[model samples]
Target: MNRNRAKWLTLMTLVLLTLTMSAQNKQKFKVVLDPGHGGKDTGTNHLKNVEKDIVLAVALEVGKILNKESDIEVFYTRSKDVFVPVKERSVMANEAKGNVFVSIHCNGVASSSPSGTETYVMGLSKNKSNLEVAKQENSVILMEDDYKTQYAGFNPSAPESIIGLMLIQEDYVQQSIDLASRVQDGFTYDLKRKNRGVKQGPFWVLHGAFMPSILIELGFVSNKEEGAYLSSSKGQKELAKSIAQGIISYKNAYYNNGIAHTETNVNEPQANTKSAVKGVTFKIQIAASSRVLALKPQNFKGLSNVTMEKGKKINKYFYSETSDYTEAKQRLAEAKAKGHSSSFIVAYKNGKQIPLEEALK
Candidate 1:
């Protein structure tokens, strides 16, 4: 116990010193923007308009704006329409040491009446409708031939999908969710578009990211009105700019004290070192709930990480996931700095991932 305590203390000290050093050094922030579905992989084709083309235009425009305004370096998964695999997107961002990733897509639905803008982060969708959206976006992985192996075994029917999902950098989930919400909310409030609120679901493309990430569904192409708007270059530009502003908001919140980069202090004994197993203690409470089911992504996307369970028999909302409150505070701040809205607390019980509430007091 003494040795472990000493180790954790060393880690904490290192983290403090590193934070000071990072504040002193102004590293160029890096972001990865993925324009979803390219090449033969045309996404959401409707009314002679394609989701791929629309997102590409928006991404390029957003990149241009970001380059002009900030010293932050941004990279695209693909510069033009080409077959880039889903998992490769996160790999590219991580390899580049990207602080944040934004995926752009235009939504589609069988019903033309469904028109709205929504954004997404990685997690299992409790909503069947959200599951379907995830299915549409994730289906792209099948095109890659070895997606199952490449993406670390994304089995659709497994009860273990939750554990697998949590394995994708438990650190970044909160921030990603928040950033997605901000973008979706900003678009609806500023652009006066339909608000298809934020919902969680697993996407193969989002896994393996070391930083906060989000997938933006610009609008539904199946909806004639939305398809036309998304098809317009002006509309795409507007959408992209709004999303960029949301990222900027997340950055400002995180970097308020002048810290940068995602690396935890290696000098610290416990900082970034893997946590060990034990039952967790959760003083969980529902914090917020929508009076109406959030169909608008912006409405719900800005919400930080907490479990959302709306199973068949019950619907309980407004709960906090607190595996470790102290560490959660620090990580949450770090996440915001990395362009996420919030951060999450990932508790390890016996060296295995477990929900905070499941842990014993």
Candidate 2:
């Protein structure tokens, strides 16, 4: 009997250990890092500094920094000088179950005078410059072996082709914009680099990512000074540090209830919550799904006061409602703490959902 008891105790201890390990693994956040353009696609070679090489160095450094974090699992699309198709890069991220996707690239222009760091979230845009950037990046598909079949008649040069592309990423637009804004802040405030601000553009690389994604234009490689700085060892380290900090800041805000533990300088501005709608009412949007889910708290991690609204192609679920903006922000925090990482405060006017900026104004 004594021997049997001892054996049972040992088995229970092993089971507990295994359970703990499994829980910790479940908590790990995966980040997919794509070092844009490689091999035959050198990407914007200018004044002896290649966009592909600079971005690869920066991406590797970012991965190194993120790897130091215990909860972050970093996956690189191509660690070495190897070409990866845009769609395949997204496929790798999806297979890895990445929480976020970041594609690193250097921008180039004809004049060589423009120099700044801009991040882009996938969207259809009418802006001439944004479209041009998208066109240039999307044009890389032509280099693929079976480009025609791979892209399915999508022409990079045609604006109409972009319109025909599926907008599956629209649900994550706000989250992507939030991260892009943080990255821009890191570049402008911490690194003292020019900030071109976050913008939306239809980039094929960002199109297929299921999670929040952004394409970072590190700096204009066409500019002589910027190109040299981007190519330098010191610049690469600093840029990597800034981008890493931004990622950490975003992770802290969304995943950890805004508790920051990283040492890098990251100053994320408070999300504007002021509303113009009189008798202002707010809600916390917890999830956006392609399929409509039943309005039950159990369906949303035991989140109470759940509501759903049907959109053209997707449905959005919101949790908690309040008249006070401060209370609404608190509710948003609670939703995030409950594993709704992308939850954001939404304002309503006369029972109709309105844009946050419009409500604010």
Candidate 3:
């Protein structure tokens, strides 16, 4: 009787282990693609070059390209010409547990001079043009029912109102910038579009997402030449291909060989001993998630000194802290070696994050 019971227990344990491993193997990288402005919202219409139709077409094409990859799963906020509330788009991405959220849009103005691609990550910026873009996109809240209550009295025209939204994205800002940069690079090198460079703006759609998010302005629809190209099938396909390739590049860098790069490691402390800089602290950001993990070596793959910054919806995890810039780079390399391939050095001065360049100086 004892031998039979032991055999049964062994069989059940092996079966459970196999199931867990299979589930892990089947995990796919999710990409949430949001096609900006649909249904009642025509977006920026310039001489019949409708923004809604163009963005939707391009987004669908991009999703189709990405869906071809076996390891990537794509989700669309709206698959057709339907109105989707701005906030709901983000809620969908969060619910899907998306690795990244991309909102596709087109720029327009009364004047037809500006004609280039601009990719934006959520943040507070003083740039007037960037703020205007945010305001234009955020104005869609007005189309939703009970806009004032839904958005908590967010006034799109008043840029100051967006300052509160910026905090929601603070944890993922670095990752968002990396993704945005890749997208902008694709537009510049692959499509030969004018490089407007990656900029920071308080985009409501991007801020509400827990993961890295970007808002892409494909090009100015107001320009006659650009509008004609954007509306054509050939041009849309080319743009979609570039955008897909950019996402693939980002995924390849961060995801690496079918394994998600976010897995933490518990290893010997990697911060090098070096001379300290006055009023400067450097930390390597390893990961950020909605999960609040205990600061334990066991939790972080045996790494000690792992700290987390808790936020309302997201938390940021970091490894090692030093005042030496060179040591910070060394720590960053160690983190990448430990499988945090997307990790980057974050510098601080007097409790505030500042540019690494300024911190070094």
Candidate 4:
């Protein structure tokens, strides 16, 4: 009887341990890191500096830093110097159910004068420089087989062609912008790199990922000084560390705001009354466009209380604002019912953008 009793207790302990392990796994934050350009693509090249080699090295280093955290899981689109289609990169991130997708690359142009790091979230922009960058990156699709059919006949040279794909990522635009801003802040303050500031552009990879996504232009490789620095191990390590820290900071801030590290928490309403704090204002972001539209009911599905904020590159239209978190959610639902399917709640305080999670607190 004593031996049988001992065996029963051991069995129960083992079962409990298994359950605990499963729960911890579910809490892990999944990140999909994509190193831009590889194999035959080679990306942009200047003298001895190759875009593929530099981005791959930095991406791997960033992955190493994130892997040390027990609660963070990193997935790589490609660890080796192999070509990967831009479309396939996002498909991989979606399949892994990543919480965020970050694609790393280097910028280049005929003139070597431009040098700075810029991060992009998917959106339309009329700025000539922004459109040029988008054109250069989107041109990669032309290399793929039957690109026309795959991309619905998207003309990479024509930045306007990407408008059709805009709605797919509209729901997560604010989150993408939030993550991009953190990355830009890290590059600017920590490394003291040229602060290109966060901007919007239509990139195919950013559009395909279901979660928040950003494409990073590490720096202009065409510039001789920046090119050599990007090629150095020290520069790569520093940049990687900065990128890793930004991701960590974003994860902690959102996680504390009731946004879990798990993939299941995405695409759902972020506002909750339980976490709402005083002085927080919530607004429904209905649409963002390059065209300036009058705040007329006719232009917005006949919805009233419409307002607009013009940014550096785009104009954002909002439905209404309120201090009550629950009421803000009701407005979000109303906007969606009015054909603004991608509308989401954005929070603000003192005219500055704060995380929906932060505002909720």
Structure candidate 3, residue pairs in collision: 265-301, 266-301, 266-302, 266-303
Rank candidates by TM-score, best first: 4, 3, 2, 1
* Residue 221 displacement in candidate 1 (angstroms): 0.8
CA deviation > 4 Å runs, candidate 4: 1-25, 145-153, 158-167, 253-286, 297-303, 322-347, 355-361
lDDT of 2 by residue, 1-361 (tens): 9999999999999999999877755576778999999989998888888989999999999999999998888999999999999889999999988878999999988888999999988877766788888888888899999999998989999987875677778767767876777788899999999978777788999998998899999998899999999999999999999999988877865553223322111222246634223666778877764457888888999897898877533356888887766666678778877877657876687877554444554
Off by over 4 Å in 1: 1-24, 152-167, 256-258, 261-361
State each model's CA lDDT, in order: 0.67, 0.81, 0.83, 0.83
Tens digit of per-residue lDDT, candidate 3, span 27-141: 8889999999999999999978999999999999999999999999999999999999998999999999998999999999999898999898887776688789999999999
- Cα deviation of 88, candidate 1, in Å: 0.9
Pairs clashing within candidate 2: none
Local accuracy of candidate 1 as per-residue lDDT tens digits, 1-361? 9999999999999999999887656565677999999998997888888988899999998888777654467899998979898878888998988878888888887778888887777765556676677778877876778877875776644434533565464456656765776788789899999887776666767767888888888888888888999999789888988988887766654442234423221112245533432355322222222223443324444444435435232222322444555554464454445444333333345544443323322
Scored against the true structure, residue 135 in model 4 reaches a CA lDDT of 84
Task: Report the lDDT tens digits of candidate 4 across residue range 231-350.
Answer: 999999999999999898778655522235222112344444453457778788887766789999899998899999886655789999888776777888888789876567778898
Number of backbone clashes in candidate 2: 0
lDDT minimum window of 10 residues, candidate 1: 261-270
In order of listing, the candidates' clash counts read: 29, 0, 4, 0
RMSD of 4: 5.4
Q: Which of candidates 2 and 3 is the stronger one according to TM-score?
A: 3
